[model samples]
Target: MNDSEDGRVQQLCSHDEEHLITSGTRYSIKGFRFEPPYVLKRAAGHLCRGHVPVVLQLFFLTLSAVLLLAVLIKGQAGMADGETPFLVTVSSIANTQGQEQAKKEKVYKEMSQLKPQINHLCRPCRWDWTLFQGNCYYFSKFQQNWHDSVTACREVGAQLVVIKSDEEQSFLQQMSKEKGYAWMGLSDLKHENMWHWLDGSHLLFSFMKYWNKGEPNNAGEEDCAEFRDDGWNDAPCAVEKYWICKKSAMSCTKN
Candidate 1:
């Protein structure tokens, strides 16, 4: 070409190259080209400034939700595997304690019911009888003569109380004092000045001390022994008075 035209064409080409370099890359005859590193850096900065925070927030939120879900699932799994036996153990312990308490209460109730019966069996005495010193005694409410008193006692499978010890004598004497004079089983009817019990026991000299002061003088046909508050006294056999009867307590044995 001519020199001037070539120079114009070169100028145009240089202007186009400058425009392409100043602006972002564009499609050219040479094919596509990338932007400047600074331009790409600015765009990447814009993307980070606009969307990275949101993306990070979403990611953190998702991670938190997943962690919470995992914790819930683990808790549920633990409950499924272990809750039943734990509850059953607590319930079984409570039931066993309740049963034991019920059994104890039942036993206590049964013992309370049987206590009176056990006492009655041990004493082996009638409802109206008084038990003392392995024997049972009955104080008659009605008055009877010596002979009739014996009959009354025999009818109840008992006999007139025979005082054998000082303790028994004192007990009977106190009882007679409170209940008025009562007939005993001793008499001097068989021989003068010699007392004998109805049970065929001879009165020993030690028993003579039981006689009241200046008593047993056999005054005015007095032959039967009557118990007084202070001591024994001889009285008329026919005279009516309250009487005492006694018997051995029944023995109990276990089978």
Candidate 2:
């Protein structure tokens, strides 16, 4: 064969060694020759020698790295999913407790407005106190004898409720429905069947008397009058019942 053929310079190993340089062989500048290995020569018909093993090793390493990364990501995601419910539950509980506290504070604030002050006109009435017709009215939560009720009203700079008009009467009637029977300012204790108001006004007109049917019969020495949903009833002065208190709206300091 020619010394140079098919882009390969055939060269003899120094001092007559047996190996022959064939096509696709490389040589160093110092005259050392390199030839493709048998495996690469068979696989690719004379490509570079030892590159196949390196390429396969790199591919496997890259594949292994990708798999490891995917496993780590999946594990982290699963851990997060497992813990999310507890975190969400705690957050919801905190929000609910905060809301309940806020509602209670709001209710207390509203109730505080009912507290009585020294002297102010048109000021808002305390909790459970209602305003009507330039007057603030309080419906007692507890029962007391008529005389005690009158005393209680006086302590608050008020008087037992005195109805001057039909509207006032209806208001008391409705209020007393929920609060039970309430003592009014009316009594016939001084004179039998002759009703008078706490302000010492005579019950002059028959139209102003909203007596329940067959009331004022004066049974059992009944003298004090109380009102219910129906109307007024003459009860004993010693009988205990809820009472209403009325104060002038001008009693509170005006803003």
Candidate achieving the largest TM-score: 1
lDDT of each: 0.77, 0.71
Give the lDDT of residue 123 in candidate 1: 44
Candidate 2 on 115-195: residue-level lDDT in tens?
554334345576667999877899998999999999999999999988877887787898898879999888888888888
Q: After superposing candidate 2 on the true structure, give the runs of residues whose Cα lies further than 4 Å from its correct spot.
A: 1-122, 251-255
Which residue ranges in model 1 land beyond 4 Å of their true spot?
A: 1-122
RMSD vs true structure, all candidates: 21.9, 15.9
Q: Choose the strongest candidate by lDDT.
A: 1
lDDT of 1 by residue, 122-205 (tens): 547888998889899999998989999999999999999887888888888899999999999999889988899988899888
Candidate 1 displacement at residue 108 in angstroms: 20
Task: Enumerate residue pairs that collide in model 1.
Answer: none
Q: TM-scores of all models?
A: 0.53, 0.51
